[model samples]
Structure formats: C-alpha cells, structure tokens
Target: MLKKAGIAIGLLSVLTGYLIHHPIPAKVPDPWLFQILTDVLAFSELMGTISERVGINRWWAYPGRLPVPRWMNVPEGMKIEKTVFHGIESVVVTPKGFAERKIPGPAIVVYHGGGWVFGNIDSYLPLLVTAAEHTGFLVMSPEYRLAPEHIFPIPFEDCLDTTLEFMSRAKEFNVDPKRIAIAGDSAGGNLAMAVTVELVKRKIAGTLVQVPAMQALIYPKLQMTNYLLPSYAQNREFIFSKDLIPKFWLSYIGLSSQYSLAQIICENAHIDFSNKQMAEKFALVHEDRVPTRYKQRPYNATPQSIPSDVKKLLDGKTKAYLNKMMLDERIAPLFASNKTLLHLPYTHVLVCEYDPLRDDGIILFERLQSLGKESSLQHLPNSLHAAASIGPFDKNLYHAKQNKILFEKVRDYLNNMH
Candidate 1:
C-alpha cells in the first residue's frame, strides 16, 4: 500500500512538472484564465490610450472605452452641408465653396463603415472632404439604417437606392455621373462590393440604369466563412476581436440575444456538410499568399462538423445570403468572374499592413491583375483598420502623408480615366 501511494505521488509530481513546463491553453475557461484575460485586455486598452495621448497612434476605440482627444476634430477649412436626399438624410462636405470651383468635375459616392451597426455619414466627413479637395471631385456621403432595427438587405438597399438617386440627379449636383466612384471603409466596403455586384447582376438582366465607374474598398469584410484564417488567428486580439466580429454580425442581422449569438459561436445552430464544402471552396486562399512569418504559430484546429439545424439555416434565405458560391463571390469582390471583372472600370484599393483585412485587399489586387483589370493599390504600412474614419486629429504627419499619397493616386486614376 505504501509503494502504491508512492507511485501515485510520483505520477502526480510528473504531471505537475509537465504542466509547469507546458502551460494549458490560454483560452481555458478557468477563473484564473478569465482574470488573466481581463488584465491583459485592460493593459492593452491602457497602452492604446497612452499611444494616442502621445500622438504615436490613431486607433478609433469603441465609445465610452477610450477618450477622444481634442486634436481629432475637423479642420476649419472643411465646409459641411447637411441635407436630406430621397428620405435619407446625409451630410455633404467640400474643401472649397461651390463658387470656388465653378466647373463640374468627378464625383465620389462615399459610405461609412460601422460593422453595419454603428457609424454614419458624419463620422467620416473629414476624410470625405479631404478626398474631394485633393481629387477635385464632388463628394456625396449617404446615411444608411443600422441593423437589428433594419436587418440584412436594408442597409444594402439604402445604399443602392441612394446611389441610383444620386446618379439620377448627378447633373443638378454639378457632377459627372459617368465618372462617379463608389467608396467605403469596413462594413461600408462590404456594401460597396455588394452594390457593385447588384449592379453587375442587374446590368446582365437589363434592370439597373447606371453603375459606378470605379470602386475603392478600404479594409473590407469580404466573407463570413473562414473565420479561422491565419489573419484571424494572428490578430484575434486585435482592435477587432474574432468573437466581437460574430457579435456585430448578429446585431446586424437582428439576432442580438446572447443565446442566439452563443448558438452561432458554439456552432450549435444549423450547419451542414454542403455548407462546409461551399465555405471551403469560397475561402480557399493560396498558401503562398499568406506571409511565411504569420504561419509560424502553432495552430491545431479541427474541421467542425456542421449541425443539421445549422444546415437548415444555411439553406434558408435568412442565412442564404451567406452561401459561398452566390454570396461569396458577391461579398469577396475579388472572387468575381473575369468577365465581370473586365467590365469593371478603374479600381483603387487601400490596404493596411497591420490590419487583419490587409490580405483580403492584397488577394483582391492579385485577382484583378490575373483578370487583366485596371487597378491601383495603395498599401499603408503603419495604419490599422478604420484609421481614416477617426479624421485628421487622430492622424500623425506620416499618416497624413500616406493619406495624401493615396488621395493623389485616386485623383490621378480618375483624371486619366475616360
């Protein structure tokens, strides 16, 4: 009995030693793990605050989470005009008075990103005004309804309808409808791609009257699948967390209840084999495209078996909008057919190196190249997602310079285009 007890103690000691040398997963649900995660997140938030306080960073934090510095305000030279168009209220901003620039020029239909839940035209007025001034184009910023209150197709429809109306009255606004560009950041970028897709599909069916001459997608949310991509893993704790992403999607789709969100997160809801197959095909990213440095981390994830209920949801229209083939190509504009791509006019994409969405832009650029599409890419090495929305005060000299370069590139692209 004493020998057996000694053997048991020896085994316990070995197990304890192994645990000491090789810690359990940080994501474990123990109370100690939760405390560590909370402390780490709090420290990250505090560091972000210090970075912004010293003018070394310009990340836009969630409201009440971070204090907005005074320097982030709009500059004095920008002229903001508040007006309602087609029952959608919006704000139009120009760098110079209308009289200062007497002649008509190119125009941009701008959309703001808020994960489809927050954000409005006013949030990005500074960037829009700057783009208009630098490109010498009339900028029209539209306001769209947030989700939960108005789910799925509502935001997409509002943007499409606004664009149609804007194009119809292009002449009245002293703009060239033929040279108009559609541009948006983040969720807005998703809408921009969706709008273009709808336009192309309609054009094929002879329903839509007009389509933008160009599209600028800044850090767009390209697909709902492949949530386990390298970027998602590498930047899981990024300003935008992987968990928070699904939360936003739930809120946008009117499933804000914690139980519903938890069901989706736990993969307990409807999901089927066919849906998994479709997602795999749609999210098939080339191994070579992903940077080598990012792949060095240890990741041992297994393919999840889709639940029958989830599969049913996938088959339904509620989640049908997220199918890989149909909605995938539509969402990931880069995956569109060459025939569709070739028809697209001049395109400019802005990517940020530190952002999880950076590779999405890169892959899209490569896809455009392969299809022989006219495209220009501006890569911002230091910027993060949604950097442009925070305005000039949040920007440093380097960011401003990069922004200028991007604006100039867009201007040159628009100027050279017919």
Candidate 2:
C-alpha cells in the first residue's frame, strides 16, 4: 500500500508541473520561447485566482512575486536610494558620479506597469536600472497603491501627488526641476500621460508647479471606450488573452469581482457607442487613424449588442458609473481635447507590433503629430507586450535583443533632450 501511494503522488506532481509549464500558446510571433515564458505567467495568474478564491493572499501567485534575478541587481555603475513623498515610497536610481556634478541634471519619474494591480516598484527595477545606465539621468519609480483595494483615482492620485512632490524637491535629488520628465509602461504609461495632462492643466491655470518636460509611454492603455481595436482582435491571445484587458481595467476601477462582466466589456457592450459623447471620443480610436500595415486583421466596427441575459447583470448604477469612468479624460487620456493636446510636453511613444495596446500608442502619436506637437514614435515589429519589463531578466536571445533596442531608443531620446 505505501509503495502504491508513493507512485500515485509522484505521478500527480509530474502532471501538475507539466500543466503549469504548458499553458495554451498565445498568438505572438515567437511561438517557441515567448510561449514558454507566457505559459509560466499564465500559471501564476491561475495561482493568483485560486488563492483569491481560497481567501489567501492573492500575491502568493503574483508574477511580480517571482524571485529577482542576479541580472536585475543594481547595475555596477548605478546607485539606488529610497525616499518618501506625499506618504508614498519611491525608488530612485542614479547613474554613477551624479553626486559630484556641479549642476543638477534631467530626471525621469517613472510609473511601473502591472496592469494596475500586479506590479510594484521592485518588480520594475531592471528596467529602471537600464534607463539610468543608458540615459545617464536620475530615474525614480513611485510605489503607487494597487487595485481591488485602492482603485482608479486613488492609484492615479498617488502617482500625480508623488510626481508633484518630487518636482518640488528636485534639488535635493540633484535633478533639474525644469527638465524632469514623466514616463511609464502599460498602465504606468497611462498614468504618466494623465499626470502630464493634469500638470499642464494646472500650469495653464496659474499653478506654481513645474510641468514635465516630456512624456514617454510604452504601449500604454490609453482608452477604455473602445476594445474593438485591430490590435485587440489580432493579438487577443498574444501575451495573454485580450479578454484579460477588461479585467485589469475593471480591477483599476474597483470592480474586480465582477468577472462575468469582463467578456461583456471585451465585446464593447459596457459602452453605449451611440451616446454622442462616447461616439466622439471613441472616434479618436478609429481604425482609419491606424496605419495601413497594422490593419492586416479583420475588424468590424458594428457594435456588438449586449445580450439580454448579460444586460441583466449590469445594474443601472453600475453601468452609469462604468460609462462615466471610461469617458473621463483622466482615466483615458486619449480623449483629452486638442487644446490640452497642444500643451503636451515633448512625447515619445514606443509600441510593440504583436501587442494588443499597439494601436493606442500609435493613435496617440498620430494625434500629437496632427496637432503639430513635438513628438516621436518607435515601433518594435518583432516584439510583444511586457518586453520592457520582462526582457531584462529573461535568458532568451530575442528578449535580450528587444530589450536592448527598447532602452537604446530611450537613451538616445533622453540624451537629445534640450
């Protein structure tokens, strides 16, 4: 009996391990290596869900909870420091020899991307370190509160407040107040632009704070009004299912437990597209603005009707609130007015061709260009989402190459800053 039990347990363990390492392959171009990486990530998401259901800490299976790699250690030429501003903890990475400089230099206040709820400052250290090393500038990442608890405006407010405080005390960090920029990846990219818009609006209204000199957004989630983007359908299962995008957005807005609504929102049912205000804003995300090459996938603009059963799931108050939140410029900066767009700081948009958020970044750049705003864009045709965050730690050759190219572009942009 003991021998039989041991054999059964061993077989079960092997099966579990295989399942964890063999998640359904995403639609990304790199099916071999990136698939393996995402498979592990998918298992982590499952663990996180199970832990949540069991009333255990959800972070136990969180991807950001993975052990840091030796490669992610502070690069030899960089030094890190922690400071508190507006009751939020922030990590600052400075290039070697920053202390002895006679004059203050440019700096970047970055927001880490984890779809809003998953990542922390430490999870993004590798990217921050690379930015500091490549750009030779002070880099800081705010540890903003995450969601399912903190929610939309709370996390957004935390970033905005921390950035304002950092700018006010820039001298202490050896950073030039006038040259400070705001940057972020994914959700962080959304915050960076939101913060920039808020600061510019404040400055326009005679506020005393200094506006960010630039905004660098990496494949940012810029709008919630339209999920029918070409990239969305094309790369729905690229890194993770595009269906998960609504889950993250819902989590950001504090509706995380409404899991059933994720698919509804993915079909663009949460939004009443015929509403005048919503239609106008969503038109900005129109496929026409997307370049001809990116339109390789089939996308139908006809709105998907909300089935009666699903309609019953959306209460009046909940639908109203979701509509309000989705259209807010602060939550979806892509809807900001041309007047506001004109005042935007210099901008750099980095997009990955195989990512769902690809069109968001591209449309943003195109809008800024149409308004004659000083802006630049870099599209990584062979890359996927989260490359900036995951590339530094992955051992894969393609990841390393993509990461190098990502940062090299960043470095050149910062170096050329006036």
Candidate No. with top TM-score: 2
Off by over 4 Å in 1: 1-78, 97-103, 258-271, 275-335, 394-396
Worst 10 contiguous positions by lDDT, candidate 2: 22-31
The clash count for each model shown is: 6, 0
User: What's model 2's lDDT at 406?
Assistant: 59
Error of 2 at 322 (Å): 0.6
Put down candidate 2 lDDT per residue, 1-418, tens digits, no spaces: 9999999999988886775664332444445656666776777766766775776545445656566444576767678888898999999998998766788888888999877877788777878887787678899888899887788899999999999888889999888888787889999999999999888888888988688888889889999977887888777756444457887888889787676577688888787665789888878987788888888766655556766887688887888888899888889998888988999988999898878899999999999999999998888876777767656654365656665665566566655767
Candidate 1 lDDT for residue 172: 81
lDDT of 2: 0.80
lDDT of each: 0.62, 0.80
Model 1: ten consecutive residues of lowest lDDT: 22-31
Q: Following a full C-alpha superposition, what root-mean-square deviation does model 1 have from the true structure?
A: 11.7
The residue pairs found clashing in candidate 1 are 269-310, 270-309, 270-310, 270-311, 271-310, 271-311
